[model samples]
Target: MDSQLHIFFFPYMAHSHMMPAIEMAKLFASRGCKASIVSTPANAPHIHKAIESGTNLGLEIGVLSIRFPTQEVGLPEGCENANSLTSLEMMNKFFTAVNMLDQPLEQLLMEHRPSCLVADLFFPWATDVSAKFGIPRLVFHGFSFFALCALASLLRHEPHKQVSSDSEPFVIPNLPDEIKITRNQLPDYMKEETEFSGFLKKLDESELNSYGIIVNSYYELEPAYADHYRNVLGMKAWHVGPTFLCNEEKEGYKAVRGQEASISEQECSNWLDSKKSNSVIYVCFGSLANFVDSQLMEIAMGLEASGKQFIWVVKKGKHEEGVKEEWLPEGFEKRMEGKGLIVRGWAPQLLILQHQAVGAFVTHCGWNSTLESVCAGVPMVTWPVSAEQFYNEKLVTQVLGIGVGVGAKKWARLTGDSVNREAIEKAVNLIMEGKEAEEMRSRSKALGVMASRAVQEGGSSYEDLTALIEDLRLQRHCCGSK
Candidate 1:
């Protein structure tokens, strides 16, 4: 402990991975550990802002840069932007970059000689590199503890064997709660055999085999799943999440893009402000979740039926083919007039979620959005599009009991035989403004308090983080002398 304990951190190129890693770095700095983060040159600006924010608050965190091919293989330049490309394409490109990252990352490790490394999902190769350098590796899963368990179960069973690819309820054998998954709801990439599934499989296995694992979750939020990690997986893991606690002064904090509108911010927030408070339904399927026009029309009609003020952020190419607002209820916009704002581009989500007028969120239930909604003290209408979202929907509706999930019973689009427009309208109504809605809102507020407390000093997350740092340093030293 004489010299600063150097800890190297590397998050996957996507924003979801990078944000949690940055928060973890802040925690390390707060506890007197020196953090050196690694990322591609394109990602450097993001890390720079995160480091700048931490340094401004007297946290000691440094960043190291790595070079990635601007367009590796088939990925285009700036294809790593999470807000743009599909998740599968991003994964293929990202892991391709990971394979190439070893040498430069190795060079940094040799030069810095950090006590340990914290790596994100999708970098299973980190284990090999850590072994080479004799440094302990801690893998971070940026999703729910439940999702981790579900994923583990999927990998263990390899369910593609039991049911025909064309069948329904595609049961994942030997998991609790009769956990049934469908083909369409499986992660977009996992729908077929390809590089994406292989990459994810490697990440899952690497995480299970890592020296230690850390999740951006809390015991209170996911006690049972945390127990599963400890008893079943036999991995020393830490659940420290709702990282929003790091943002004490919510106001004046810059959006992740760092700029107001040019090139990144995209004027999304200014449009949101023009709508009425609690009257607008904010819809974002997250950085991923492409939609066909028919599905998009269903959503638009559902929102229209609610007749509530609304602000919608539609991703590029989300609408169904040949579909437009012409399919929307006639006179809808004219009726709502100044009440609705729809931006067909990138949205300043954190800012929008935190806005006082914003009452509810319709999100894909990504951990980032889950935590952000809690931090903003806003209720959510969970519309988990795919992957672990089914588990997340469970947490939102069954476990937390604070939010309404459109896909609580099923994970596919509403158009399928499973659910239709009536069901969609009903779920939306129950969540947006209905008899049970206020009680759900109250419950969400209560959970927000618990979420905040988990990240504060002496809280579960704080204690777990401390334990992780101590254990990591000790393990790294023991491995070094061997």
Candidate 2:
């Protein structure tokens, strides 16, 4: 059963989900294992480009393209990934399109008969598909332990339902610490039982039934939560990440990561060269965040007022004229001049965070961005827009003390919450200046060191990864791969 070992990764059709899985696959490949990432045609290019370096180094990493039934589900063609989604309503259709991949993926399971399948949280069906072929399935959510623990508590306790108002804070019962959250801050699906809520219930059952979960987290970052996840909640998990760092050794590797057509890493790096160490702030929302024009204007004004060196990567949209630059203050770019760099499309995020000039990050608290900043030792002004970002905000500002929240009191997939200029300025200043800021920086640097240690020999993540690969090898032998 252990003959010619191979593993397959099927991540949700989002860059955040796919890239980490790619890195995880690379880690397996580097350890003399063969791995393949399964993706649709539209999303396979990203997987192909990301794995190029590892593949060139003679690692047996490859892409296994799967067909997504786009036309049947009524989503626009080429809408294989969530980044291409324009609205929340379209997301349902896109997922329906994704769900349609079950048959094709099942066929692959039958044909490949891989040792294990590491599937995304979105694909609860994979548990059964892999079981059909006697293959183990591990869940990858691209999140931290704290977020998962807190979410588990929320779903189990229903504390938010007991609260009187959206703003009324309720203690998330049975966590490692006392954490309070409001109804508004939770995902819209969690606020009440919806069609999606039913789906999440299925996801939870599948997770419990799967072989184990894979997290892009380290033991040191949230020791209490990690322990609680395994011990108290009774879940099997391996924290083998910040997975993106697995193969960052190659020269000019940053450019290939999260690559887009515009704004090369060299261009971004040259701009950072002029600034002093820990002087400039890097601002970026994750790909799915769509801020209304007013919110975008507020961000521009807030950054301008902060009087700090900054780089803002604007998320490109489908609008012909692009959601009105009139949202920007008049002559704003001219006024800021050399002090500010605004990249209209993709910016090399990992490269920018690792640079010497980056003091703080004003981030939307996406798990990848949060972990990237943590790895870089950059403190954050946590502006959580959607998903489990609010839970991550709590982890940073409350548990870790490496970030300050920007008073983002609401959550929506397409965020229209316009936090005032003052709140943004205050959070930025707190993360960048004063004794508190210095202390936060010191703490962040220490955590960054821990992150580095986690990936090195004898580290927790290193051991977990080794143990996981070996366990898969053993499982293949014992279970008898069909």
Candidate 3:
């Protein structure tokens, strides 16, 4: 009773992973626990800016850094983060650099010896590293319960193999819902055996050996999958999110949650104010996704054909192979001058989605983006590109009924999906108007309200976080050293 509990949060070097981990750390810090975020030198600066408010309030929180082996691993200087990669071929060396952090991270643990380490799934060795110091390691998967459960079921039952073709949809057995997925939609780890797939195996093993999981989700968001993951899969877990709701709504707070805005929030707001409620569509893939000029053209033409007001978030691709395909048709901007706003970089996504004039979203179905759309009461046209996004698309289109799929059939980070403008236009039109669209909007709004309440005092997320912190404290008392 004479001491404070200190918790260390170590997130993967990605925006989605670090942002939520920072929020969760602040949540713990706000509730009277000493929290510190662990990152490599490059990633540590992001934490500094985000935790300023918490530190200013005299909350027990700060940042810690680990040395990344850049030269030894053949990666460029300051290339510790995943977003720094210009091409997929560079992943091998980047991953090797990440793997080399094991020793430095362990050295830090020996020095600080925090009560618990809430580590991201990227570090499969985190479990063993924390165990060396008798510290509890909580795995932050940063995904929805439904997506996790669906993956678990797929792993348990190789239903994808039962189908003859990669595109054939097969029902994953024993899930809470009758979820159907194709082999092509699965992550490379799930599709077939490879070096990365073996790494994924290690990640799964590490998670199993860890103390428990801390998800960025709430019970109301996917109650069935929550129960299924706990009761059926039997993993020790706790849900303490929609964690972004922890921050008090201040001016431009939402705009800069994940990253700095390329365009001013006021400028985006003025554009939104010009349109009526439920009229505009916002489209964005997350930071790590891109497409060839052909796919980009399809999207541009689709938005043009939808004949609706829209805001599209895009990034300048680092012209690989010295061939920069034209992403837009001739005079496309002139045609969309008033009807659309093309934000050619990191736009304030949460800001745009939560606005009254924004009705539907066209998203790549990243967990952060999907959950943000859920919180904003906006339905989606799901176009999952890579990672677990395809599975998330299933959850949205099938189980949740809050989104429609754009018939994206492949899974790749930098993509050229055969999903042409017609498919894009059809899905956009379906989710933007008519009785079905209204019903989807109503369901989304109800879920958004539930998400809000879940983070309030005495709500499910509130209590879960309270319990999680207390549980960590008790575990430290039993197992940790001073």
Candidate 4:
């Protein structure tokens, strides 16, 4: 076995995708592996900072930046990541730019010849590229085992095909758990034949041939789904996460768009200090989530009605003009004065969740957000907006019993359907003070303890990480001998 096994990581450009991979790289480096992460120039700063933090802790993690083919893809310069792109058309161009990196990535791998490659699922060609250099490629899903298993089952059975209407509910076939999903909740790629569907099909096939997968979850959190992915799906996989917990400070990586501009960290912390322990609700959607003006008004009214001490991070809406004051319900801010704190742009989510005053989270149920909530031991009021969030909502509300949904029956970007103030108020009540909320809070606290333990020495995720490093070393040796 190599004395210092070298592992290269390639993450998709989105913040949610890149952050986990960055943390995973730091984890590998902390375990005495030489870890390198590759990203476009525009996205490299955050990765570099994360690696620098790892280096401060004596981890051998480095960042390599490549020039994104912006002009070739007809995209504006610096439109390298998913969050930076403005429209679906630009998104398509971004994918094209990502695909164009195949040749450069192949050249980079061949020259460096790392022991293993950890890549995002978006890069189907990574398996082949790694194989060309005789290195194992482990696909990273950036999702929970539960969401992965459910989506895989749906793909295999195509149960949504039987439903004639988008509103019709259909039971996902061949799943270990009985889960019902409406047709509209399905991702756009899965609901109809599209170019992205073809891309995903290829990605799935590539994963089958790759070495295995590495998921950002822990064994105690989803033991059944982990087993199903291993035994039922017949894949070699490792669970070595809640990866963000690996960072000692847990200050959160600097986002590509930068930090929250609305309030100072000290001000936010001081505000929380004034509140009782577990008495505040923290509301934030992931980076990509946007709401219409009408929905924003509904949310403003709902939070006022909940009567709970809350801190809400409100990113500017797509249709918003001038100031956010125009988007909110008239006189809403004045009416709620001391009851709520609204921070515009990116809030320090990890920091906020870690605060003692935060009791529950109102989240879009993104995998990263969900895991963060769990690690914080905070219950949730789930409002799933898009992508795999709906499935993640199920994991929170039904499977884990640590969350209550806001009755979001359909999926839409920002325009389709609005969850009124009434539903939001009800969900908030359920998570904040309902009889069931007490039980959920207890369960959440227990799970948070488990999550924290899993990443520590002699824990499940810790052991898995050790095993993965050893296995990769052995595989490297085998390849070298051959």
lDDT (0 to 1) per candidate: 0.70, 0.87, 0.86, 0.85
Query: Which stretches in model 2 have alpha-carbon errors above 4 Å?
Result: 54-56, 317-324
Go through the candidates in order and give the clash count of each.
4, 0, 0, 0
Q: In candidate 1, what are the lDDT values of residues 362-398, reduced to their tens digit?
A: 8778788887776676777877765577767767777
Ranking by TM-score: 2, 3, 4, 1
After superposition, the stretches of candidate 1 with alpha carbons farther than 4 Å from their true spots are: 71-74, 82-94, 164-167, 170-179, 188-193, 254-279, 317-334, 407-422, 476-482
- Tens digits of per-residue lDDT, candidate 2, 1-33, equal 347679899999988888889998988888878
Mind giving the per-residue lDDT tens digits that candidate 3 earns over 187-217?
Answer: 7667788889788778889988999999999
Q: Pick the candidate with the highest lDDT.
A: 2
- What clash count does candidate 3 reach? 0
lDDT of 1 at 251: 46
The root-mean-square deviation over C-alpha atoms between each candidate and the true structure, in angstroms, is 4.3, 1.8, 2.3, 2.2
Can you give the TM-score per candidate against the true fold?
Answer: 0.85, 0.97, 0.96, 0.95
Stretches of model 4 off by over 4 angstroms after superposition: 250-262, 317-324, 413-417
Scored by TM-score, the top model is 2
Select the stronger candidate by lDDT from 1 and 4: 4
Model 4 earns a TM-score of 0.95
